[model samples]
Target: MSTTRTRARIATILAGLLVAALFAAPTAAPAAADPTTRHRPSPPHVVGTATVPVYSYADAIRESVWVETPADSDGDGVRDRVAVDVVRPREAAAAGVRVPVIMDASPYYLCCGRGNESELKTYDAAGVIAKAPLFYDNYFVPRGYAFVAVDLAGTARSTGCEDVGGPAEVGSATAVVDWLNGRARAYTADGRRVSAAWSTGRVGMIGKSWDGSVANGVAATGVPGLATIVPISAISSWYDYMRYNGVRRAADYPGYLHSYVNGRGEQACADVLARLRADSAEETGDRNGFWAQRDYRPLAGRVRASVFVAHGVNDLNVTTNQFARWWQELAEQGVPRKLWLYQAGHEDPFDVRRGAWVDTLHRWFDYWLQGLRNGVMDEPRVDLETALGTWTTQRDWPAPGTRDVRVALGAGDGVTGTLGGRGAQPGRERAYVDESLSEDALVAEPGTGGSGRLVFLSGALTAPLRISGSPSVRLRIRVDRPTTELTARLVDYGTAERIRYDSSEGVRTLATESCWGASTAADDACYRDTEEITAVTDHAVLTRGWLDAAHHRSLRFTTPLRPDVWYTVTVPLNAYDAVVPAGHVLGLVLGQSDPDFTEIDDRDATVRVDLGRSELVLPVTGRAGLPSVAVAPSVVTAPAERSSARTAPDNRQVP
Candidate 1:
């Protein structure tokens, strides 16, 4: 049989087995023999053989089953199937119980299907989990909630392989919820009261990376049943993911495409990848067209579910700017949202920090689905200030009192005063040699030397410097070449070690007015000067400008383009600090290119600093002797009433 036919046969067999089991299991109570009474709703038949005896809510629920639903919900041309796992309550307690439901859409294809059954079950049974190394199912099922893992429509045992975003995927998710409700009723032995369990109807969603993206998409449907969502490592802008800033992200694109197409033995994904690969750079550049169609930002307002967006501070694959855009857009629409920034990487999902994340999810569901009198709703909406690893709550993201600090770059050797400048002065420029590396270095990995880079350090801070908000840099530079690339990185220096804080890089393509058309030439002149012209090279360039480190010149005046043109580039530093302790030092590292990041190569790339024209700007927050503040200890409120004490209210502040 063909793959589709084989899958269909398996689904049919599973459904038949479930029906048989339902018929075989003795009913707890019998209804009247009257046809009318028989016509009334009977306990849902438990179709599949019970691999594990049904237990109480306390023991832990773990059962894998395939849910059958009409492939075509609306008699549409297309059809699909949704596979789900129903994790029952652990202990054998009362029947009529309302438990929270967590619907996790798996990112890895194997984890949700038979291919990964053994591994998933091991984790499910063993209760050990990590994001990068292991599948997510192991971590979720043991958490005392019904975890529904959906195989989506086209992967593993499901039908239809068109993974494109639309009704198909959404319908699959909806169908899984319906199936879970039925299974929950069946597991409750058809008790009328038990069938009315809280989770049988209420459900929430949470996932990381691809799973997270799906959660965001499903939430956008405004599905009434979906109570809340926690999307981590999810990019809001599809355009940004496929094309960075604006340029096609050559390095990551092929790998991602390959994973979706061939990773799961799903044939349909091959076509989608083909189309994506066939699209030309120009075709992909039109953001308002098909690219926008794939983006989630346009659908942000459509998402009615409360959301907790988590992103890493140093996610090179998906920059922090993307998260900033997501937060800003959601806020602009007045969506109930929370933002969590961590000092980690893309694969941080499976990290131990996930325990805290899972706890947060549980509290959110308890508040929304259980209608508990938990203070989850009243807790600060934002958590985690990057510099400070500790959890800090806030009313909103980019909270009040966020200050911007400017750090200057100047020509300098190891630790010399020769290139000293007191905040913005023009001087004779000196160039530093550019070095290139054979291979790209991992951004998070320390101490792999590469080419065209400069490092500058600030004197040890006298007092604890807590910098929050974005970091921007202004630099004076001249390049021997017509066009150059520049990269800047902010580093927090420890006495024994130096760690990367945040970085941004970009490239500058020189403009030759002769190459432009009459209309284009006019526009170019309007933006660019003869000595230093700024032309509308391309939006892609601007998008790449988000991280390009092509050129930097003194900000003093319009320096003429000579043998080496000196121009100043002002770069924004988005990442900031809550507090850099007094003992630590602040450092800035500049490079022509970040090998571990983008492959922007510039030979003979030399950055000259007129020390007389440089200064390092730091944003300092005024401190009050560590004020005493009361924080809620738990995510949810306790059952018993505690002493009524109110803490001094600090008007939700952010700069």
Candidate 2:
């Protein structure tokens, strides 16, 4: 839980020398004045936006230096070294105006590149960067910020073996931040010292996915001089990213990904890659020390910077739980924060909601870096996107003052059972085989119990209801086997067609273009037009949760079940903000396996549910924020149960 646990200083420290482009010779322009001074820009917030066009887009300096780390992740015995690419306002450096830095540290730069364009960095003859990936430099350097693109240890131009998401990867990135603050060192190719004279020593890390995950890792160190971070769709725990409970989302998923993004020939880092597979403990899929070392949630209280968190509800890749758990820790620590909960999947906010995202980022950086009174911190803390692309600003996430509404499961006259029933169903239990099935099949005709799942529905909604946060599935059940993994999904089923968000991965790029900032031949700030990915379907998955029966006691510890023993377990679903319209049936699908997520577990165990003690607890803001749908009737009644058996406390928050 402490930074010192894996901290090891690199011995071959190199002082940061002159950064080429940012340290360019003096220019002859009024806006680009003070070239002789070489550090500060003429005016701060000159353009006053993320796209402020002041610096030369074509002239932003692009250079690279190596940063050494103590971990020999490459297994070569020699400590690993990281490659850092810098792009900054040449005028700011020339003017002697030390600027705060915005950095994107990533391992994907070598393989998948970055952003929607899939851009990989282009290098010059001397191994310096000729062109960097993405639009951060194109857009922000002009606005007076230095942008650093770092190649994590063992990836891209860096020297080392890959350790996947282990300490080597985390420590290597942290070393770069240390170098920026003069707490560590960096060196040029010719062995020249490179001092960060062009920097204020204040840094803000930003990125999506793996890139963003690094940002979280660095901040967790409780390091000084890291001013802020904007982690978009990032991983808080590598364990959560690849596994749920004791069952894996995919066996050795990180090992496979580590090899893929390493860029080095497989043979060069073969031992490192092999070790990842062995250390991953894929067979048991249990949480181990390796997972704990990569976990950043426990270090939340140590973070010194403000956080701007963003995540999409439909991001099956990272899932909402990863973000929610970290965010919860940050809240408990009382760290300055802001959030944007979108409706897309595995996406970047800049790509989904470009303009607003940029403006907010602009203000955020200004307030933090330049010490401006932009009122960004004073604004509503949460901005939520709806299923239809509409948005709302909430005072706090989960819509402040909300409570849980428990809906019990009961068998109805039809195939699917009843939800929000007053008592247990006519049957003592409902059962399904542990056959793998797509979510589509499980919810397609919920009324007709699918082969792999049992669906329970509430009466036709009399009024619209929306869930602002995560939902939990509390079930009291007995299993015939010693262990089994269970999956539960919250869905909406009806005749009306809705956007098939999951089909297209939540976004569809259009033929047109949407420009964010200025552009250059090497990197353009414009991207393809993207509209909300939509579809007509009878079902829409609101959220889902999973648990290993063995993990029913604790994710950190395994407890094999005793057959025929009834146990009450609580499973927290991913967080979401969606409005379920009136007349659309709300259903809960309980199944043993999901083909898209879990691998097949051959041990089939019959599960017996005590319906009277099981229910789905939903977080809702009492009849508010449910616009565009008809109101519910006062006296609601379903075909199955007459009185509601919602046995849990009402109007009380769940955990």
> What is each predicted model's overall lDDT from 0 to 1?
0.45, 0.73
lDDT tens string, model 2, 312-392?
Answer: 888887888888889889888887889998878888887778888988888888766654555777899999986566888
Best by lDDT: 2
Determine which window of 10 residues in candidate 2 has minimal summed lDDT: 646-655
**For residues 1-655, what per-residue lDDT tens digits would candidate 1 score against the true structure?**
7999999898778755554432222220111222233344322211121112233322344444444444543233555544455554544224444455777765344543221111232234333211111222333333334556666665544554433433445556656665545542222212122232436455677766656766777776655556567777775655556543333334335334444523335344556445545542332233444455446666767665667788766555556665676677677776667777765545333241445665665456555444443466567887773432356776765656654444444333332211112322467444554453211221111222233344454454557766655555566666665434455555444432212322211112224322111111111111111121122210000011223333123221122244445555565544443555664445455555433344434355566766445544444456411111121011111122221222212211100
How accurate locally is residue 161 in candidate 1, as Cα lDDT from 0 to 100?
45
- Cα lDDT, model 1, residue 211: 63
Q: Output the lDDT of residue 77, model 1.
A: 50
